[model samples]
Structure formats: C-alpha cells, structure tokens
Target: MKEAQKIFSRPRSLRNISTHYCGGCGHGIAHRLVAEIVDELGIRERVIAVAPVGCAVIAYDYWDFDCSEAAHGRALAVATGIKRVRPQNIVFTYQGDGDLAAIGTSETIHAANRGENVTVIFINNAIYGMTGGQMAPTTLLGQRTATTPAGRQIGVHGAPLKISEMLALLPAVKYIERVSLHSPQEVLKAKSAIKRAFQSQIDNLGFSMVEVLSACPTYWDMPPKKALDWIRDVMSKEFPLGRIK
Candidate 1:
C-alpha cells in the first residue's frame, strides 16, 4: 500500500504562478506566511483581507481569501467597516510603507488608537516600490529614492516616521512588534509574531501590529545580497527589529 500522506501540507491560498513582484520582494514572503496562517487557523473560508495601493495593492490575486480593494490609503477604514459588520470574520490589511505610513497614516493611527480589533501587516521597505522608487514615510536618513535623489537629509525632508513605535504609545494598542525576514531565524520570529497578532485578535485583544522591515533590492539599486546587508547594517539601526512595546 502507498504510504499515508504527511500531516503537514501546503496552503491552497497561494496562486500557482510566478508573482509579478521584483526579485527578493518581501511582499511575496509575507503573503505566503499570512496565507499559511489563515489555513492553519482554518479561517480560509471566513478570512477577509483588505488590500491598499502600493506593491501590495494586488495582493488579492495571490491570496485565496476573500479580499477587497480599498482606495489608495483607505484600507484601514474599509477593514474597520467590514470587521464591525462581520465580527466573526478575521480581517487583515496588507499595506506597504507608502500606503500605511505615508498616505494612510491618519487612517492607520485612528484605527489603532480606537482599539480596532484588526490585524495590520505593515511592510516597511524604506522606499516606494509599486510607483517606482520614491521616498516613503519609513525612508531612512540619507537614502535616495525618486523624491530624495540626493539622499534624505533631516534638515530638508524631516526624520523618518517610526510608525510601530508611534502606535505602541497609543493606549488602545494591545500588542505591537517588529520582525524581519532577513534569515531563517528571523523568519521564525516573524512567523511567531504574526501568529500572536492573529491569536490576539481571536481573543479580542485589539489593534495588534507586526511591522516587518522588508527589503527593496530593485528600488535600492542594489542586488539582493547587498539589499539584505543594507537592511541588516543600515536599516535595522534606524528601525530596530523586535518588539517595540
């Protein structure tokens, strides 16, 4: 007789095709992780994901969960509405630095401060990706993007926005952490954090967030290795991976 299939299995949430993201883009990894969690939690039938404009704008295509396309910078508002009406469904918003920290800062902040019971997967790659390399709210000091061609200087452009830290200060935020996918170890930590964030909501914990310091090799004008090195040596110092509060 054939051997029984292993208990472990892959998620059906992912599409069976090569993604359109650039090589080494972290969104694909994050999407896979989220999808895995959805399947593991057996919420694939009831999970609803909200996608915003940015590299993650088309996340719906890759994830098999029910998804809604929100206007640029309006994902949180849409997510809040869905969760309010359908409290039984698990709601998550996948957003990039440009969408979450820049254009949608108000929406994100209000959602967290209001103690909204939703999961936020905020990807901070430092620069804009989908709209070409441009400065984002998380863009580091002295980093060049389309808007900051000569590198970001605080005297002119202002300091980078540490959104996770800022949200951690809000009393309504129950759990907040930052993790990276730079290595296998870090990937495990991120997976744990993502799981906790979801479990927290399942317990009605409120406003949990995992700020993932991702890499943007294409926008940084560097190869995948150097982009990762930059994330380790440069970005980590400014953003610092781990629980902020």
Candidate 2:
C-alpha cells in the first residue's frame, strides 16, 4: 500500500468542535484565520484573547487559548487592562461591528490613541448578527434591517460609520487595514492583514486593527453564496480593502 500524506488538518490553536455561527457567516472563516496565524507564530501558549459580546461572544469556545469574556462593547477595555498588566503575553480582541463601533466607540478610539500594544480583529458584517439583525453602526445607507424596515435613510439614520478610517487618524495607531471574505482571493488577503496586525503587536508597534467585511446571511435574508456576493459588490464599496494606516 502506498503511504498517504496528510494534506490538511485543523490548526493546533483551534478547538475541534462545532461552531454556532449561522450558515455562510464569515465568523468561522475569521476564526480559522486567527487560529492559523497563532499556530504559525508559535504564540498559542502566550496568546490571550478578549472575546466580545456579539456574534462571536463565545469565541473563547472555539480558540484553544486563554480567553476572557467582556461585557457588551468592553472587549477593548478588557484587552487594554490585560496587556498593561502582562506585557509579555500576546493580547488581542475579537469584536463585531455592533460591539466595537456602536457602544465601544470610545474604548476603540482611546485605545488606538494611547498606542496600546494590542491586536484587534474587527468583523464588520453591517448588521447586528447576534441581536436579531438590527442595524449596526457600520450598516450601509439604504440597507434594510430589523430596526430599519423602510431601508436606512440618510436623513433618518445618517451615513454608515467608517470606524476603520476614523481610527487610522490617530498617530499612535501602528497599522489599520480593511479586508473582506467575499471570495477566496479576498479571504487570503484578510488572512495576511490579520497576520500583520498580530505581528505588529508582537513587535511592540502598538494598536493594530484589521477590519474584516464579513457576511451575515441570516440577517441579510440571502443564501450563503449570495451573501458572499453582496459583500463583494455592495459592502466593499463602502469599506474598501487595503491598509489605512
């Protein structure tokens, strides 16, 4: 019999369990990318992630590393405290658009301004995935949601909040990039951006963030494939991909 080579297997840093993400949700892909980067950087032992109170609220259940739960919109605050106390550990926060931009805006901006040595993986799915598809701070103008049945209006809802660009204005911010999970090519780019963010923290560059334009099929009321397409066609226009800072 011919010897078989193992071409694929789960990353050591990722837990082997079923995820609770909705079908076609980009959280799963984002989670895998983080785990892969952690394993590749050999920082699994020292990685401490602060999970947010959004769609990825139970993110600690997926990643096989030290994790702490934070109150709604408090992931960055918790991560800041953890990093300040234990500068030796690799600290990061996994948050969603609702958690980071809506309620946690203050913490996000202040953390970047202070140049805190922490990595932030921000998933911008536009809608609040964990909260019955409510409109999020990043939700596109004219997009419909549970709270915006008549479609988001410029006068009523205002424009979508470009939080990534806002944070890039801070001098203390080391790196800021926006990536998407609409296609395989974009997914690879997202991984690269995430890795760079993590590496920035490792190099003590301070305040690295990667804003990933992810998909929420259930909220969007679209099929899995259509959700990905919508990201590439519609979402990317508002939040273009590339390094901002």
lDDT of each: 0.89, 0.93
The TM-score, computed over Cα atoms with residue i paired to residue i, of candidate 1 is: 0.95
Which clashing pairs does model 2 show? none
In TM-score terms, which candidate is top? 2
Candidate 2: lDDT of 24? 89
Name the runs in model 2 displaced over 4 angstroms. none
Per-residue lDDT tens digits for candidate 2, residues 28-76, read: 9999999999999999999999999998989999999999999999899
State the local distance difference test value for candidate 2.
0.93
In model 1, which runs have C-alpha deviations exceeding 4 angstroms? 1-10
* Deviation (Å) of 152 in candidate 1: 0.3
